[model samples]
Target: RITESQNGWCWQGPVEVVWSNPPAQAGSPRVPAVGLHSTTALLQVTVEDFEVVCKGLYRALRIREKYMQQSLQRFPRTPSQYLRAIEGEVWRASDTGPGTFKHLEGFPLCLAEDLGYHVQMKDGVVYIYGDKAAADRNEPKDLPYPSLERFMDDMNFLLALIAQGPVKTYAHRRLKFLSSKFQVHEMLNEMEEIKELKNNPHRDFYNCRKVDTHIHAAACMNQKHLLRFIKKSYCLDADRVVYDAKGKQLTLKQLFQQLNLHPYDLTVDSLDVHAGRQTFQRFDKFNDKYNPVGASELRDLYLKTENAIGGEYFATIIKEVGSDLEDAKYQHAEPRLSIYGRSAEEWPKLASWFSEHRVYSSNMKWMIQVPRIYDVFRSKNFLPHFGKMLENIFVPVFEATVNPRAHKELSVFLRHITGFDSVDDESKHSGHMFSTKSPKPEQWTSEKNPSYTYYVYYMYANILVLNNLRRSGTLLATQTLLGRKRSPVLQYLYFLAQIPIAMSPLSNNSLFLEYAKNPLPDFHQKGLMVSLSTDDPMQFHYTKVQCELMPSCCPSLGLGLRGPRFSGKPADAGPPLGQPLEQRGLCRQKPLAANTACGCRSR
Candidate 1:
């Protein structure tokens, strides 16, 4: 009886079969004639007898082929399916292979097939096996499989396709499958061997190009697991800098920190050396002889050296540090000092000195830096007197520089500092009078009236004072001192006041026109002026003359010409008529006189 093998072949019935008296031979028989017997009994057969037995053999093959194909219908063509179908053959032949055969090795033939093994039928079973040695011999040396040298490269290629973070379930399953095929523990050991080989100074592993695979493997894997693996298998030296694709050294310190690993040998010496190298690169003048300090150390140094430096020098340091200067220990310095001195007592003195010095010199740069000082003052409530001094001192200097363009900016600055509408009240001060109704130019020229220079100075002083008050957040006091009284006419007056400045050549023509049309007495006007002033002037280079006089030409015939023409009649006029009464002859009331003249003409 033929026993069917798991490999889908039956081989127990007979080793050979013969057929007798088939069809005549087409070609000449061999020196010894051979023929097939009709009966299925051939103890021995030679290659020459195949033709004589061809018909019966062919019939048997057709029957077997039909049977095998029908049996194969239940088996899938997938590697796993084929392996399962052929598992019996592999198990039966396990004793015959070169390797020591165990009854059940549980060798995961499924993975073996996936790795490109072939399945074949032998005896009464299917066999799933591969000749790894043969496969390796056939492949180019550069393309060896299960190779430690290529592992990292393969891992890197896989990693490039994955997004960052945890591995997907599908990928984990695949890894598990791969792990079953090869001895994972042995593979890991091999990886270590490769690492050691690369690190061997005598071997010139760099020339072999093996180290890159390790790096790629480490980077591509789950960072946590990769780090653990690296720590276990390789001696990762923190001092040894690794270059990335960009050619910049990937700081292992940062990577370790990101992984939350307290890296071995991460000492202060290492950090200092790294910092020194970085600093030297940045500032070529930086000397490496003096070891670079950390941020905390530098802060401490600043505090110690602050007193040694004069207030101006200290101020320079503060400006350099800006908001980054946050050492609570050094809070007792003079708040008004040019460099963020925090002492309330020193502010008035600093302010006084600044005011005195400013009068003799025009230092726009120094003036610009004063805002930072104000910020320091705000942080530490130095003194009310100091705040008052700032108002009295700096605002005037800032305002005095104003042309019509600067005046608008100064107005905006005042509004920003005071938190008061720049043009809210127009009755109290000429500073708010930007209207066509402003006092005529002749008024300032008269002896009784203030000179143009005097008014200019007054305007400058008011702007300075108001800005200081605004900076202090004393909006009420600022308004009391500088805000004009509100009036309906003042709205138009304010509109008019802005016209001259708005039309001045120095003003932003488009911006001024925008303001003139919108006429938001509080917000947009101040905002526009402030925006224009602080931004670069080169962008909107309006001449001062145009800004000063454009309002005066409005409401005139020429101005109205751009507006709609008045189509209605005069208010006192009667209804319109097509003809006059005189043309209608209704005024010829002397009828008798008219008749007499006609009779005389007839005679």
Candidate 2:
């Protein structure tokens, strides 16, 4: 049916899109994207390539800070951690230790300038000047920001010409994209990422709504008006053209930027019960009784307060999701499934709802994604706590769950990022140090004998079920859709964690990264099935595809899809899990699914 097509820049070759998430964003543009509709087409774009680009950009920016800082005394311990003396206030590197190097982060710009020359940016042009300048401008062999300029210039050059593939005129709507290769497309670079197209792709895929799987169902449009919002969100006009309420005027991409400009702020403002005393005005679903809104469920509070009146635009979204709120279904009062109240306390009820609805039990080629450890709604104070808890607590639990070698690497990580000295064998530079390796979960919290937080326990129980499902031959990444038999040792346990620096801000400084550092690509390599996701669309102002972009110019994270396990042997006839890790497909190279369901969402 020609579900989606690539225009702007074209390569006559069959263009493919591997949906990281099917319904990536609600009707975003005049053109259709992932979550605009619940379509069967799915594509998986690895985004590792873009991650490489982000790392490089982050490092380059780091070096620029060092050059501006000009602090030679405080030599950067590593290439990424810069120490510039001449700066007003130098920013710290997003990461540290040897791992940053592996990601292709380069030496600091100041040190790089020390290599040969020092160049400065005056107005818009780059030239050698000041003390570093030579009489002939050629005297200073080294440039101040050579390393930064060289790579970025090359990246910009490549990105410019690449998206505009040998300009073959294509038709869309009525007018042709014949002159589509103009500067606007070049500026937006909005063409389909041709380099990411997968061959022999999975044509039939799922597109569940993003951020809906989390405990914060209200963080979205809320249950009181959910079906109404859903109708507007996925509503199609007479031309089958998708428009969110505001989307009628602005494209989906523009809508996302607008959301980003004013993301939802999750705070004590959310725990506010006294914001208003009017009972009826309060959402009917919000109970002053059981499961009243609190810090854990701040999205609800944010919606009720900051987003109380969404103006004409929001009303339009409600109208669209309900198919105009006056459609036959609305008029008849038809009852659709109530997908709401996904709080921690409501897991049992939520699970039952999914089961009763045959959400996952049907072997329906679905992905059940749980949210990551990020906040439900975007907030200034959200990430620090989440990162602290994850590094300090979950790392140990995850270490125990995986095999020995993987466990050892996690231990190394603990040594480097933490401060506690090892009890048995001392190690250098640990992350959230505890005296002993794999200490009891009790060691993390002040409460005696309590192993982990309530959420961790919840996840552990769920992971046990997921692992069991994998062992019992029910789960096997994307292949499960084909109904193929899977091996016992192999697991389909997947996670969605987003990182930054992979691409630029929509304009200049769109996103702030520093204390919010998380680079978990290494985990993805070990069959963890970890890919990035956009958790809160309204908060993050991103479409799934926009969040997944890899700046065309960054270094490439080795692009290898998860290949097959069992080699030509039968699934049940495979080697046992006890074999050396290398022999098994624990680290296989096959593609994973992006069209599945997961809980918890992040920006």
Candidate 3:
């Protein structure tokens, strides 16, 4: 009942099973102790259990601290007597020995201060020093995690954190710059001030991805939450806020009202909007209603969108938000477009729209952020359209594509973009034998050999395009090289020509321990300028530590010493013949990886 499959996996009982064979030379297969139950899964499960325990412990400590503070009455004869009574009560209540249920040990005041929170029990009510909800990752900004009542209190805590050291004016950037420059003790004064001002900098965007170079308000903000109005006392007298460099307080609801435009997807409800601190009587009616914010204005902000109206809507918001916030003055931000749809066919029109209405301002000018460009590989002819659009559509200087999949087609494409092949005319079409595939090694006559010809033309044309774009600080390259399986020639050219690379785990690759992650540091060491960007933040299983990724995902996001890899035949005393690694059915360590991406030699 066993069958061999082309992809090296076996199927049985509606499931696919993979067999592993190690130490091929020893005539035996190695079975790891854990088998496919990798260490990564083990660590993830362990971390989750630990976090659950930590969260429960923190909650217990909070309850105990509150109860102890409430026990204090009309000033016990002396402060010492009051403290002693509270300590004795806690010791009796805490049943740490057998976990019948008891208070967890509380952190000292100094510890809380160091962590940027305060725990004080002054009045009958306990006031926490920080946003308690922020500690909970499951809390969504647009939707209350617990109930409406709890979220109101959490919102106040978040706002209070911001109010402590507000950025009232743009006069202090110079000091901030100096602090980040030296980052030493002498600049501690500026460093301290910068820290206070930049806390929750992503608050205005209503999102948490600070690594983003381009942002979209429509993608992050909830129109429903922005328009909701509750009694002033219910929200602690807070209202929806949108920051304007000119000091105009505009809310999502107000922005539409002022512009006199309505998008179709949102439903406006002003009833629950926060009113005065005056507690309402029982006669109040719920005014909150879902408004249609998803009108034509936001429909086509994504890439491959065919609707011109949608594109214009996206463009208008970018301009409107930029103008309102004066992002150029503060942070020099731009718009982002994630285009993976079959939209390369619509490039001419999209480019036309972007060209005529490119965003330009005195302090900042962002061409347009198109981060995902994977669909262009649908045809050999598709990529040149994108290359031409680089100039025609006024694309942002920086863009990224999926790695070099379909090396055969990409070979044709590389030639097309480099101008050796022209747009399909009566004389040239995609099927032309000249660029159908790389010329054979036997056919190689410097200009005819796919190896030499591809290397030469790609370097010549791409270098010109790259150099021009570099002057303006714009770049175009691949996002993930993990599964591309490109030939060694392509790998060498990418490095020699200095193409940018963004590393991301592809389909079926573990974010923590994929073999692809190994190439990242090697790429960097080989002088390939690379960037790490999240492919789909929502899909990844996030932990508190990984959420602030600098600590864990850096250098290598994946797990363990890559299982031992041996390439090619061992060296001998006689002189060796130079042949393709694939030709000899061997692996050789050159340009990092020993195996061809396709796991076969160039035919």
Candidate 1 residue spans exceeding 4 A from truth: 1-381, 384-491, 495-532, 540-603
Clashes of 1: 44
* Residue lDDT tens for model 3, 1-603: 223444332212101112233453352332222133232222232334333322332233233232222221011112223223334543332221111111111111111001222222111111223444543433312210122233234334423422322211111221222223333322334444344335535432222222212122233212333333212111432234432325666544454455475333334442222212221211121111111332322232222234423344445434544453344333222223333323433434444444445533322222122222212332444433323322222221111111112122221111111011111011111321223244322233231112221222222233233222212111121112333222332332233223334343221132222433434444443334343332222113123213432232322222110100010001110011122111111000011111111111111
> What would the TM-scores of all predictions be?
0.16, 0.24, 0.26
Across 1-603, the per-residue lDDT of candidate 1 in tens digits comes to: 223344332322111221133453454222222332222222222223323333222233222222212211111122222232333433232221111111111111111001233222221112223444544444311211122223233333333323312222222332233234223323334454444445556533112111000000001112232224324322544544322324444443443453454534434453232212233223222222122222222122222222212233223333322222122111111011122323423334443333322211110111111212222343454423222323343333233222212233222222111111111111112223222333332232222322222222222323322222212111111001111112222122122111111111121222122223322222122211100110111112112222332232111112112111110011121111112211110000010011110001110
Q: Count the backbone clashes (under 3 Å) in each candidate.
A: 44, 60, 33
Q: On residues 1-603, what C-alpha lDDT tens digit does candidate 2 reach at each position?
A: 122344221111112112232453453333233221211112121234223322333333343333212211111222232222112335454322111101111111111011122333231123332345463464532223223234334434333422322211111100111112222333453344322322214411112111111111222222334333323432432123222443344443343344442122322233333223343223232234112233222232122211212222333332233342123211101111121112322223333333322221110111222333233312333223332333332233222223334333322221111011001001111244222233332233332211112232223222332222112111121211110012101111111111111111221111221112322222222223222222121223223222343333111121111111111111232223333322222111111111111111112
Please tell me which predicted candidate would have the highest lDDT against the true structure. 3
Q: Relative to the unseen true structure, what is the C-alpha lDDT of residue 134 in candidate 1, on a scale of 0 to 100?
A: 43
Ranking by TM-score: 3, 2, 1
Residue 277 error, candidate 1, Å: 38
TM-score of candidate 3 versus the correct structure, residues matched by position: 0.26
lDDT of 2 at 3: 25
Candidate 1 deviation (Cα RMSD): 49.1
A best-first ranking of the candidates according to their lDDT comes to 3, 2, 1
